[model samples]
Target: MTNWYKSWEEFHTSLSKHQNQTHQLFRLRSSTSVSQRNKQEVHVYAWMTSQESGQGPANDFVQQVDTTRGSISRFGTKNVGTHNHSLGRRQFDNHPSNRRIDEPGLVELVRDLSSACSKAKLIMQHLRLKSGQYAQKQSLYVYAPIIAHTQSYLILGKQATLRDVHNLVAKLKAMRNGSASVEERLKARLREFCTQSGNTATVFIDDAKTAQTITLQSQQMRRFFKAFPEVMLVDATHNTNDAMFKLFSFMVHDVYRHGQYVQHSLMENESEECLRDAISAFKEFNPTWEETKVIIIGKDFGELALLEREFSQAKSFVPFSCKKKYLRTEMTKREYGGTNSLNTKRAEDSIDMMLKATTLDEYTIGLKCLFYLLDNVKLRAEDPVPHPKHTFLQYFMRNWGSCRQLWAAFGRAGIPHLGNNRRARDFMGYLKDILKSTMGLDECVDTLIFLQSVLRT
Candidate 1:
């Protein structure tokens, strides 16, 4: 029967009395602590077995007291075995099959493996391999004692599983990164670059609102800018780091006719002020920046206006391919043909002809053809709801038509773009090859500089 004791001492006194009277042994199974009325109480469990019995041992006597409700419970167990619950017995008398490493070096090996984020099974295999025990049966066998030791070494206070190792690695990585602020880390990396390359790169650190920007241009880049400043390409990449900052690159064609990055800026956004600051850095470092004659870019309108204001002499050229992609996206909008594939293709083909026109006369004819096709478009009986073709026509007129001379082929006929205006697009693929999606700004800067050094040589 279960009884509630006022203290742990009282419970032990009563338990000893039962053991002496019945000549029984108690093996502690486990214990659980509960808080009741702002006070902590523990419930201890022990299974009883008779040492020398005339009748069978009372294995069915189970008592559990719920301290919260001040209630008692009793249950029966069918099996009971002799168990030595003494701490000394547990320390010396383990199963013969259980493995333990007594060598100091081997024990430290387990700790090293665990610290290196090895899984329990893998660590066991490595240990077994070192001991020349390569049996297939031991492949999945994990030594519990080594794992317990590893847990202690890692300060985990419990058995170390695969997830625990992963958490440890993640914690260490976070601690390493947290040792310095973002700005400090970036400045250190820049300093390392300067020490190695012997080039005093331009850097801008803004501590206001955490929208700090860094513009990098080495001395070699300055020489390239002065010699080959006829063509320039500017583009920005997103999701480069956790801060959501955009990386903008200003490139120029080197003497070898290869697109080489002259300047790179990591900014908080594409705001005009940030762009102006980056451009000003460029103009400050390389005096021949105004000598740039042709600037090729994607469809960043804000960048276009800023570039126009800063480098008015340079002709801003957007590739026809970029315009085609944008126009095709607009064609799929609801006000246009929506999901009507046939109408979309027809509109796209006519627009492609207009954009591919070599002269103003050919452009006009292609435009008339587009208008004619839009006017004559008919909806199929099985098709979904049709949209007004005039919507796309109006959109083109309002957005692209007003700036036809900027993106159209006829207007860019005489401009020298080194046979293409997609230099920025080509460089994007190279950047993606060297950069990962999860790199921080400091790592990104280091990687870019390392690769640039390799390319510069």
Candidate 2:
């Protein structure tokens, strides 16, 4: 079982003889060796089989060696041939338990009881309080161990922590959601919708890495477009889904003067190509898309241009409300000092007044007033220096001045826009109430279809 040497010379001779001949002797770390109360050193050493000695011991092996009196140390050797030393106590200690649930049956029972609850700590508390109730219903043998474990770790302060319960609950949730990817689930829901109704939906995969876009329109959407193809409002909302894709909503006015969503597309980005793909889907699903006479959009010039090119007969207009919002955003810049400057306020008022001009002549006069207010800033007697609104003035003249008719009232005076962008803005508020930022893509699709059904009512 064990080999003992009497003399230090005999132990050294055996250690030297066993080095490469039959076995290997290795000294354990000093921490493994302890001194007794009398101050006698008890060294720890390891002796491994010659076959595994060249590769070193697979695990730590400690043996109490008697170093008292130059007598040889008591050496203990494990038979590597008969028994495997690979699986030591450290192997069990190093096991991965991040996703492991110690009480899986308890987790499942709790999950079944509390499907709506998400807080792991609360669920644990409920379980601890009502363990007797569950034990009465289910097997007492099965729950007794659970109750004991819970009391030991949670109440009595043992090895387990609260984080352990949270991790186990998270693992349970992951398993409950199934193994399908989010995109696959989204596509499955779309396919199920198309099969249930005579609707159409298509997904455009840009590439493996880049985000994708899904364009969908129901049967009622087609009828809405055909009934009222004169005007349309195009806008986008973000953070509606976990994928961070922008949900582009194309709405139109119904007979009741209600803004109804006619088409929707979840896009990766609002690039021209992505918009074109969405519009192409719209045109394919609704033949009356080309009959749109008026389009109201945001401050995206590229989107405006694309809409013009796609619907050549349609006139696109960015309403005054949107223009005011854009201007106010620009006016808040630190570079322009602030909007309280006389020149900045005058310029803003003049622009607002200019956008309301009904005739070209009136617009021309309003433009002159705007320039005069910007150029002739009445400086206080204390400071005679020119106003620092040159940056804002230049920005306005370069961007807003160059595209006057697009945002001005006279641009689409001949066309009917109903309430212009008021209906669209209201719809955005409605969308915020229904959708959430943490929703998955499949959940977003389901919510969108539900909203469409509600609007149809």
Which candidate leads the pack in lDDT? 2
Put down candidate 2 lDDT per residue, 106-224, tens digits, no spaces: 56766774344335566655555454444455544431223356455322111223566566655665676699887777878998989956699888876575546788898898888
For candidate 2, the TM-score is: 0.62
Regions of model 2 farther than 4 Å from truth: 1-173, 207-211, 343-345, 377-389
Cand. 1 Cα-lDDT:
0.68
RMSD of 1: 15.4
Instruction: Estimate, for each residue in 274-378, the C-alpha lDDT of model 1 and write its tens digit.
Output: 888888888887878778888888876466778898999988877777898888777788767575633777777778877778897777666766666676644
> Which 10-residue window of candidate 2 scores lowest in summed lDDT?
153-162
Off by over 4 Å in 1: 1-169, 175-178, 195-198, 205-211, 339-342, 377-389, 419-421
